[model samples]
Target: MYEFRELAKDVYAFLQPPLVWYSNAGVIVGDKDVIVVDSLANAAMTKNLLSEIRRVTDKPIRFLINTHSHADHVYTNHLFPEATVITTHSGREQTKANLELQGEHSASYAKFFPEFDFSGGRYTVQDMCFRGTFSLYQGAREVRVIELGAGHSESDVVVYLPSEKIAFCGDVFLKGMPPLPLEGHVSQTIAHYKLLESFEAEVYVPGHGEAGTLAHVRVQREQLERQFERARECFQKGMSYDEALRAFAGDVIPLEFQRVVILASYCEFTGRHPETKDPASQSHMSLIQSVADELRVLLGTKEVDKKVAMSR
Candidate 1:
């Protein structure tokens, strides 16, 4: 009912409402069956998504393809028990690790944002795994799933429909949101952009935010390059992370976005996450910096870690 739009033919995208994880899902109506790109955050969200799918198409959903293994994108895998769940080998492993890791921190996270929920024990792992490329055929339609590598995560992939000229890009091409450097390699992310472009798809659906075109992807790619360069410039100038943060916060995007870039830069330059992870532990400055970097990336809020100021 909100902003679900058809990208091409019978292909559709479900844009997440703001209060949720701000993720999106893609739906493809095959000749005789249906293929789902990703699931929503939890049971309730999946239920809502399923209702929307039913509204547009009555064909049976034969396959559930996860672009990646992020909890927001794959937590509802259990709901589609009838369909085969698909992901890359690394994606499946990361999904399992993510489930365990998220479960461990859900309590602390819930305390911060009450909307955080994954229905407790309601997650399904991948039923089928692929190494690099996989394809599915339903009636006359064909869908291609290609692994672009561990750019956003350990293993990131995108779904492309050759006939429709549409690509269901996961978090690999965030629109307004800051491009997360989870793998600590923004350069690899640039290369993945080329991979996505190679598809020659007219329409691109990002896992988060709105659906856009290759031009949008190109702009974001340029922004990512500049963001990386700016971070490096700040570091090379011997500016503290805070100084660099202030030098750019609200300069291009929002402070939250700047923090994401700074966090990524710190993680990339340091070659490791701050050794001390707990924010309240008053751990080493490195740990405090690392924790703040991680927190800003996880939650895009204006809150800054005051302790980071003490490092100066």
Candidate 2:
């Protein structure tokens, strides 16, 4: 079950549901309809979210703004048949690439997460794709969707409600800790932070954990800076990326999150060989597989657990 918190007027965030990968979803209610942001991980989870949305309002679902292409964020795209989907062109590109890249190995993921089957998951690149920014007019209110170049993921999007001074920042701003740096460029997270600061929102909704303010955002910046510094130091020492990753502990970041961020940042520092083909992509694929394997042992889990992910 997810707790709904009305952050502004009729805008509510479905906080920390069990089936999600520690991600959140939101609904902005209007007089006649509603707009949603970030669907859940799989069909089952999306169905759960739909039922929750129905319980909250009888208005027709109007729009679905996808924050990014992460499986946990966009796999339910097909479930919202009535909603007009929206995402950035870059976001769409990344979504397609991710689906192509991870589509086959989904069986591997299913081995660990039986509840989530990425194998047959459908990819909806959103009904509309904008490059920089787009605005939606709901009755008298305006919702602006801005593309944050690349952050936790490639071309992450944030929903800004100027009227409420609340920003629904997807994975770009995780609540309690340093958000994962999984983009092709680790430098993007730095710029992402800068953009977030510019927003100056009174209330911020994160993809995971709970809702927070600027203080939580500051914590995110500091933690990420520390990660970058360590990564840089390791790089200067001519240490292997794997070596740099080995040096990280749960204190700086939980090993799992730190591993992914480190891998992405490290590969970024080196270079991405267009992760479509075999050998070059294998490097990343193997790293992800190993990381998942590590997570499995650390949590003693044959299946991924939401509670453990949330507690972090």
Candidate 3:
């Protein structure tokens, strides 16, 4: 079941009912008004969040702040038609494009998940869009929404509540899961993380996973930096994309995730191309050769299980 937990006196987070993936929604309630961070993936789930908010206060929900333009983050935005929806200018464009794309293809995607229905529904675009910093005041409290340009997505925004020392960071950081670098550049992502570290928020709310501290965010930042640096080193050494893919893949880690990351990294490093030979194929091959050689050396010193587990 979906449940909402109060993270602070005026902050509340809701865990979406577990499905294939988990997502979170948050609310910042002031004495006179409230603001919702992101809408859930579907109408029913978003309605549940609205119900929860109604339970705590009768104050109207004045703002719907979208962190990015991902379908899961803004799909149910139409539910809050009365609220002024706000997001980065790029996010607004992406959201409009995504909605049109989803409306045309969501039925096909829904076939993969027979449990949920995706019919003639549509998402609402942001009413207000900004390029840099935007602020909104609810009674005496001020909420600052800042766009940290092109990190996780082209329009990633972090909402900060200075009075409470709390931040609702969108998909820029996740707690436990290795961040999915699908629509992002590694360098920009790293810079975004560094900017986040500079903030003095006591509580950090992620778009996914549990709420955490600045230390946790720092660790994730470091992990991404390491991954990108390693990938770049391999690329600089004349390693093909496929060679790099195989160098990292093994029986220990799932092949699908590895392939996706390798391909995504290749696109980030070399730029996407349809006519050129598949660079990922070459990188994958090199990766396999490197891993095999490393394994052989480790086998002489440790058990196979220990060696395999240590790779990650």
Candidate 4:
């Protein structure tokens, strides 16, 4: 399920149910055309989004700005055939690489979720790619798409409406969900939050969860700070990745997500990727996989779907 919110005059948000892979999107209606913030996870969801968009205005979608290269956000890019898709150069490259791994991802996800299907889905990369800030005017409204280095992903960007003080911050800010430092570092994610707060937007639409104010941004920031501090302290004590995970094992955050953040923080401080030749990092990655498998055994489809339904 999803909720459509009219954030401001001509500015709208499509908030998806809070769960893994589900993402929020936005629509900006211009005088003659329209612009979309990000695409949803799959084909069905994107179709629903398009239907809601048509209900508001039948103007041609001039541009579709992607916030990052995550599968959930970019999988349905092909849906908007006429619109020019925009994303960071790194994002486009990542999307191309990720496309190759879709089969593996689908197979793995199928083991845990048989109903979540990706068959018959088409993927798309950005038509226009840039390194830094890209600004365009939608009639008179200034829509600024700013790439905030790396945060939730290597291609993280925030779509800000300067005149209206509304920002569509991608995975950089998740209101109810824990921010996954999936392909990025904790330090950078924390830094990006500070920069987002500096925007002082009256309304901030996160990549997931409902649109909120700066206060929501701050709360999420504080959680990141706490997790980072704990992880750092464990690292300073020369604790192994497993030891560090055990240290924060009692955290209220879901173990599946908390472990990833812990591993990410560990990698950030050590300056190494799990896929690197480093033995320690490889072991950390193995631990993450073990925990994931354990989680799958514990929470079956019914429990996971129940959680998703409750999130709505």
Candidate 5:
């Protein structure tokens, strides 16, 4: 489930639940036109987002700004025919490439996301590709889309409103959860956090989870620094990636992500990219067992589900 929340007078955040692979977006309504920060994962969610925007105001959507090239954010770009899609040059290229790859292997996704319907999904890359920073105005309101390179992905951008003091930070800053910086370096993630803090924005709409303040950003940054330091110590001790992952003990939300992050950090420390071994080449039974084990830990059993339901 998702909620359309107003962060300020005319600024809104399309916040999704804290489920893995779910993303959040933003809406900036101006005098004549509107700007959508990012799109949703599937056709249904994107259509729902469009309906929410129409409910707010009848202003035409002029721009769909993609914060990164991840399929969860850019997969539904084709739905907004009236809007011009925007992202960084690298973001556009990677989006195009990844979309092609996804199309080639569309069947594999169902094994993971059974809820999302990806059938008949059309891929749409950004129309306008900028290098560093691009600013646009909807009548008098200025929206700044700046590319903070190679953090969570090859190209990460933030949509900022100076007057409103609100920023739509993409996956680089996840509220109350760990960021998957698998495609980027830990050092870059730290620098990006510092840059985000410098904005001094009163409201921050993250790529996932709820909308929060600067304090959330600071907390995430501090957590990442501490995790990286621990990973570094493990690396220095000549521990393998798998050993390091098991060594970093915590009961964090989405503990599986912490395992992957530890793998990425250890790989970087060893001066190599995280190995992308094809599961298809491995033993199918073992692979299935491994996935089941991770899922069991992540989603929990019936008792945990009942507890969550009762809390809700």
Candidate 6:
């Protein structure tokens, strides 16, 4: 059984079973209705969430709010067939795209989890969608669902319960590990953080971290700023993406972090901005230059071991 921790009077969080790197779900039980902030990665995980919610309240789930379109976040929407699945306009669109790629995506994951069933056999599609801010009344308490603009994805929403002083932030801030900017624009992501900080929530529940204060969110913002600045500096210096990654290497930086930085830098140099239409061609001169520049930085920093350098 997965452990459910109550972060506030009506708010609860549970770690997804099976130890999937960074996945968690939350429940908000109001006086009259219940709202699930995010569904789990698969049918089994969603079942666990539903069972746990039943333990706390018999009230029907009035809404299933998706924070983004990530498979881990929305794949289980079908579990709550009766509840309305709501998300930002962009989120809805993205989920539809995700569904189209579900087969291919699942196959990729199956490669990693060879023994596990990757097909989300029980997952359902979201039926309802909204834009900007929308409020729902659960008896007397009002639950505000607002899209804080493109940050982690083209469409990401943050749930706020002013009455409870609690906020459900999906993937905007991950505790312990550095923030993941997989599908985001650095400038917009930083801006989104500032907007999130302006909210008056006392407790913030991240998509993949311990429930804590808004300060935790701010820390993520700081880290993102540092990464963006580093990337930008490398770009200005005409360092290639790989070179930038090599230059930034340190004992404190992990291999995964280096890979992400390199990818992000490459994307930036190639002018592959998120939230935009796909490019006609993936190849670009800017990307080549960026990679070359990055390589130079790496060689100068001497971070790559002699063996690794020779291997390259």
Residue by residue across 2-116, what tens digits does model 4's lDDT show? Answer: 7778999989998875555668998999999999988866777887789989999999998999899877788788899889999999999988887788777666556544545
Tens digit of lDDT per residue, candidate 2, span 47-138? Answer: 65777778878999989999988777887788888999888898888787766766564755565455444532566677888888888878
- Model 4 poorest 10 in a row by lDDT: 276-285
Better of 2 and 6 by TM-score: 2
lDDT of 3 by residue, 150-243 (tens): 7667768899888888888887877644554555366777878888888867888888767889999999888777667767777788888666
Ranking by TM-score: 4, 5, 2, 1, 3, 6
Taken over the whole model, the C-alpha lDDT of each candidate is 0.72, 0.72, 0.70, 0.79, 0.75, 0.67
Which residue runs of candidate 6 sit more than 4 Å off their true CA positions? 17-22, 115-123, 273-312
**After superposition, candidate 3 runs with Cα above 4 Å error:** 17-21, 111-121, 251-261, 273-312
What TM-score would you give candidate 2 relative to the actual structure? Answer: 0.82
Model 3 accuracy (lDDT, Cα): 0.70
Question: Clashes per prediction?
Answer: 0, 0, 21, 0, 0, 12
Error of model 6, residue 143, in angstroms: 1.1
Off by over 4 Å in 4: 273-312
Model 3 poorest ten-residue lDDT run:
303-312
Per-model TM-score versus the true fold: 0.82, 0.82, 0.81, 0.87, 0.86, 0.81
- What C-alpha root-mean-square deviation, in Å, does candidate 4 show against the real structure? 3.9
Reference-based lDDT, residue 119, model 2: 36
